[model samples]
Each structure stands twice: as C-alpha cells, then as structure tokens.
Target: MSSPLTLAPATGGQRPRRLLVVLGGALIVATYLFLVTVQPAEIAGGMGSVASLVTLFGFLGGGALLVAGILPMLSTSSLVVMPLGIALNIAIGQIAGSLGMQIYLDAIGTVLVAVLAGPAAGAATGALSNAIWGLFNPFALPFAAGAALIGLLAGLAARYGAFRRVYLAPVAGLVVGAIGGLVAAPVAVFMFGAAGTFGTNAIIAVFRSMGDKLLVAATKQGLLSDSLDKIVVFVVVALIVYALPPRAVRQFPFARTHRVLGGRTGALPAPSPVKAAHGGGSGVA
Candidate 1:
C-alpha cells in the first residue's frame, strides 16, 4: 500500500497564520453581533423604513454570507473558524425567526468544516457558534444549544467516517437533528413552559393576520418545513464537499488542520529506497 500523504513541517510562520485565524474569527464574531443586534430589528421594522438605507444593509448581509461561504476555503485553520462564524449567525437567525431551514444550512457548513478538519475543531466551531447566539438573544438559548448539538453530532459522525459516503449524509443529518431536537425539547419546556405553547399560537396568529396565502407560506416554507429542507440541503452540501479534491478543500481558510497531520511526530515517513525506485527513482544520480 502507498504511504499516507503528509504536510510540510511546522515553522515559526505558523504563529502569524494562527494570528490571522484568530483575527478572522474575531471579525466574524463582531459581524454576527452586528447582525443579531442590529439587522433583524431593522428588517422587521421594514426594509423601507429608512428608505434605501436598510435595503443597502440587507445587501451587505447577503454579501457577507457569500464571502463567508468562500472564505473558509482559504486555509486549514480558517476552514474551521470561518464556518464557526457562519454557524453562529445561522443559530441566531434560526432562534430569532424560528427559521429551522437556516439552522440546517449552518449545521451542514459546520459538518463540512469539521470533516475536512477534525472533531475538536468541529465541536469548538459548533459550541462557540451556538454560544454566541445564546449571548445575543436569550430567547434563542434552547435553539442555540440545539444548533450546537447538531454541529457536535455531525462532527462526531464525520470523525467516525460515517459522512464520507454521500448517501449517508442525509441519514447522518437526520440522526443528528433528532438529537438536537431532543436536547432542545427539555430546555424549551423548562424555559418557556406553557409560554412556548402560547408563543407558537401567537406566531400562528401573526401568520393568520398576514392572510391564508402568507400563513400557508409560513407553515409550508417556514420553520418546520425549512428544517426538513435544510436537512436535504445539508446532505447535498456534504456530498458536494466530499467529492471535492483535498487540495480544493484545503483552500478554505476555516478548514481545520487534521490533528494527525498537525505535529512533527505525525510527519510522513520517508520512502524506503526500494519503494522509491519502484515508484519512480529519485532524480538524484
């Protein structure tokens, strides 16, 4: 069998790269905070409230998400960190609006990053993403926890090699999502108590007020429906990422460095002379 591929040995240069990763992570956190604290209220009040101003901001948020999706591909560490940031925004958005579909997308992104990296990085991304949402919106704490759990579970699945197969992606997401729902249920009961029932009713009422068409849209295309859709989307994204070249995967800035490949001890063993000769002799005379 061929030897495993190995990355170059570490150098002091890693510190600067690490610093960049930290800074990038910090920037993501800040952007999420702004989105959570500022953007939603603006969107709710009406995009036209400030005329073109709010619309401009909405465009900015969309642009940010696109950039974020692309950024994780820039480097190994970034692959993890950038996705963590996206996951945070997704969790907060899900909680704030009960947009289950968005949460699913975030979960997918988390799993992709984790699989490319490893579990600890995945868990960190998951935990931190949910934690940030929790801090921003107390009402979302349960969902935040759920989102984090989904990330963690997805990471675990990836670690065990369960997600390497495209066909298993949706199954893995469904299993992970069910676990997340279980984690969120008790918390919802504890925190919202009967209020959650009332809250759901209130949401239904609001949808009703918007008319049957809107209500149907909300129910069919909203949180619960979106959650299911997200599962499908997550699975698809996982499949696509799985098919990508490792070098392409490595391009993401948030991609995690595999722990096995991170240290000097794990460096690829030098090829034996016989094997090298058989494969292709070294150009050296």
Candidate 2:
C-alpha cells in the first residue's frame, strides 16, 4: 500500500516570508479600494489618465512586493514559468478582447501558474500581468485586483485538489469567477460607468435598457462573463496539465508536494533498518 502523504508545516523562517506576502496582498486590495471608493478629486476631475497611471503603479508596487516575498520560496522552474505566464495572459487577453468576446480568457496563465507554483506566486503573476498590460491597454488597470484574486483562488483550489479530477476544475472556476465578478463590478460601475469589453458592455447596456441600475447591470454582466470565462479557462488548464509528461508535472514543487496530480509526491522515504541501526532513525514514524 502507498503511504499517505502529509504536508510539512512551514518552517519558522518561512513565517516572516508568509507575513510579507499577506501584507503585500493587503496593500494591493487597500490601494484599489481607496481609488474606487474615495474617487479623489484628482482622479475624478479632469485627470482620468492620471488615475489609470495611479492604478497601474499601485498594483505594480503591491505585486512587486508580493513577488519579493515569494521569490525565495519558488523553484528555478517556477521562476522560469512566470514570464511565460505573463506573456500568455497579455497575448491571449488582447486577442480575446479584440475579438469582442464577452468572456475574458485573460486568466488562463494566472490559473496555470497558480496550479503549478502555489497561490502567492499565482497572485503575483496575475497582479503583474495586469500592471504590465495596463501600460498599453489602460482598460486593464482597474481589474488588477480581480485578476490577483482569481490567481489566488485558483492556487488555493489546486492546493485543495480541485484539479485532481477533470470536472472539479470547472466547478472551482465557477466559484472563483463568481467572486471575481463581484470584485470587478464596482470597478465597472464606478471607474468606467458600465463601460467594459464588448460583450460585457453590450450585456450591461441591455440590462440598463431593461431598467437595471448601472451597478446592478455591471454586476450581472460581470457574473455572466466572468463565470463562463473561468469555466473555459480552468478546463483548458486541466487539459494542458494532464497532457504534460509525468516528469514535467513532477518538476513543479507545489504540485508534487501537495500531491495535486496524485503521484508518489516525492516525500522522503523512511530510513532502512540497517541505516537506522547505524545512525538513529529520524523521530518521524
């Protein structure tokens, strides 16, 4: 019979790093909330472009801090994956937006990173992707928080075995997308005044025509588009993961440590009797 795997507790040294990640994530959320809710005269008046810049920098700073915290914890392989993930998010997201697809396929790379690296790294990827994309596409700036949340949630889902079965990934995605929509609605209503991508804008316009308030319309549109987008993204990521060679899959420390893909998990073997006799057995049973 195969031994049951147990996740080791975080070491004392890791606690500080974990704290840094939490603080950085908190900073991102706080900055976004301040911008959306306060609507400072500087931002609300004639300086909309400045607001976009602020949003970009705020999210970028937070993401950079989070990545700093997560750097020591990542494997070299995971580090290599980050840039590719960012590129994937930008390239696919731009294409989908250009095509006027209602569902944003932007989070595929974020989810992919989250599933492979862990939540913190995934969150960093999502936040960074939006910050960089915002440089060229100002529209993406306001949604950085939502993107980060999606990444964080995707990693958590993977950690909890959401990817263990094919069907469960979509279910997890559905939940993540619903929450993402909630996170995004205020940005749509307050920042853009119901303006968004083609599909979402059309949906919001239809809702408005039907007598829904802007906030209500934005929220509904977000729910519809985000949920569908996430379901598709998660399914695609699952297929990609499954298609990878077992050796490739095992290279991801997060996946192997957590048994996310259900293999041997690479836990250290128990000492042999002879070795134990020569050296004492480690206290672990």
Predicted candidate 2 versus true structure: per-residue lDDT over 100-160, tens digit per residue: 8646688889999999888877887887788788899888876776787888899999999
List per-prediction Cα lDDT, in the order shown: 0.46, 0.77
* lDDT of residue 104 for candidate 2: 62
Question: So what's the TM-score on candidate 2?
Answer: 0.75
Candidate 1: regions farther than 4 A off:
1-104, 142-144, 194-230, 250-285
TM-score of every candidate relative to the true structure: 0.46, 0.75
In Å, residue 240's CA in model 1 sits off its true spot by 3.6
Candidate 2 deviant stretches above 4 angstroms: 1-16, 27-65, 94-102, 263-285
lDDT of 1 at 32: 39
